[model samples]
Target: MSSISNRIEQISSSKPGAKDYINYLHSLSAAADLISYAKAIIQIPDGAIVARPVLAEFVSYTKGLADAREEVLIATLDVLKEKTIIFEEQEFLAREALAEVYEQKNEFTKAARVLQGMRLDSGQQHITDDQKVAVYVRIVRMLLEDEDDAGAETYLNKCALLIHKCNDPAQKVHFKLSQARIFDTRRKFLDATRKYYEMSLEEAVDADDRLQCLLAASKTAILSPAGPLRQRVLTALYKDERSVQLPTFKVLEQLYENRILDQEDVKQFAEMLEPHQLALMGDGVTVLHRAVLEHNLLAISRVFSCISFPRVAALLGMELTQAEDTIANMIIQGRLSGRIDQVSGFVYFDSEKSNLNVRQKALVRLDEVAERIAATSRDVRIY
Candidate 1:
């Protein structure tokens, strides 16, 4: 091993030809000689400008070797980083490699710190915007993986500013996806849903990504506050012919249409969700199911001026008491403009009277205007 190490040292100092370096690496691999290979890597003179590429290649080759020790690789990277002024690009590459090594070892914080340090250090130089965006995207991903949404969000904004610098559509999509995920993790569902829906419409988004965007938008839309906006989003998703076959899409459509969702429908739809999806919107499905039932009840109220509690229960497929409580809550919440007669057990839909009141108010205003016009005419006389 010492003789092999001596020969590697001599070759590295002499800055041998590329073929010679290749032969040396091949012999090292053939013998599974990790120590000598590491020595050969470290012995490549730092100031050998002509041989820097070969040195980097050797370092990368050692990193890929199964027998290479973590400590040795990290130490080699540190050595390379120390010579950044001499080989700036290679130093950057070395930092990236070191961070990856830390990541492979499950030292995520350490990995992120390394990358963050690289970003700060490179800020002093003429780093390309694409490179900066790349680093920011990576840090954001790492921070998100570490469950630091706030930290991820900070970097995510920085990435957004530099996103235009990225010419690669896929990379831009990746950053946008990451930003959407940050919004999701932070519970900004509406914003996330909007972004996901937008991504679904992007022509650059591949079929798989488009499908995923639609699914995510559907899930987030369910959690969004009930309003015309949510309804509009659901309508768009339902009209998306590509998603017509998805089970979640079917569920969303049924809920939006105020159709009663039975247990079997929910069960089958639940099967299509990933574990994380189930966790994120498990309660959302329940709420949506309840909303559907209530919406159906509202429709019933609109159609029938007065309906017996039992009839309401029958229409909603619920027990009489559950129906009563649901309607009572709706009335309390002002969602249903109606009154429930507890003694008679009837729900009187006052929507018609509510409309009539508006008409009556309009007539009263018209009569007052006519009276005012007559009085003004009488006072004006022949003028």
Candidate 2:
């Protein structure tokens, strides 16, 4: 640390006068060890002031130093921006710090306006490449926060261009990830999936940032459109993996119910689901479809736990009367082995059975009625 500090001092000393010294300090202050740089910055006095105008500049430059250390940077900037420390140079530095500090504080539009106004002034031409990148990133974040996705995309593209020009690999990766997110938000599915997939692979191979890489890969594969191409992509993704995280049972059921996946796939998907997810699948199906399946006595009891009779009837393309008669006949014929709720009209199935003469006879008659309806339907061809 001392060697680096001495080297910075040597470089700055070669350039005569205050402006060069301030520029040197600004550059050094953006180093990884911001606290040491900050302490070094505070040691430089400008004219009669206890600290130099560059001190605020340094603090504002490193405002995003790790979360815990950010407070010191923020506090330092606040002190420099105070009204009592007034000089043309000092005021300019203070305004620059104000824009940066406000951006870190997420006062985005205010920061943008400050930066925009500053750009109109000749003083803004002195800003560095790093400063422009930081400012534009804040603008992108602000636009995303406001749900102005197009604006966010424009700003992020600008940041990407700047970072690319600087040849900063780390920031390039970050900018690409941000671009992927923007595409995701815009529902540019193929673009998002491809970019995220590439980013994840690069991050993984470089072993630079594992968690972010894995997250990118997960999101990429999770939302990718399914077909032959998607299957090939998944095959590559899982080739060396020990296990894969499948989509939720609800999602699978929806795909199947909508004919996105076939019945065999739906059954296989259901078998893979956790019990709770399986239970939720009933509600995931169309109301009329679920009701029809339940009325035919084909639906599972676990599925019925999540659905009501009216919803089931709606699924089956039947009226409440039809549903009630179907369930009643099941009970009467000793097939349901359940009790009927008189109030809500819900049928509660149990393992119990009833032996009766009158109900059995009535159920036989009910079956005849159902067969008659089936025959009548078969006879008609409205189409």
- The TM-scores, one per candidate, come to 0.67, 0.40
Q: Which ten residues in a row have the lowest lDDT in candidate 2?
A: 273-282
lDDT of each: 0.69, 0.51
The runs of at least 3 residues in candidate 1 whose Cα sits more than 4 Å from the true structure, single-residue gaps closed, are 1-5, 12-23, 30-51, 67-72, 84-88, 98-114, 120-126, 142-148, 274-383
Tens digit of lDDT per residue, candidate 2, span 53-136? 455555455544545334554454444443333423443454555566666677766665554433422452355666667666
TM match of model 2 to true structure? 0.40
Candidate 2 residue 121 C-alpha distance from true site, Å: 10
lDDT string for model 1 (158-244, tens) is 888879878877778779888778876765667788889888888899988788888888777765544335566778778888777
* Sequence-dependent TM-score of model 1: 0.67
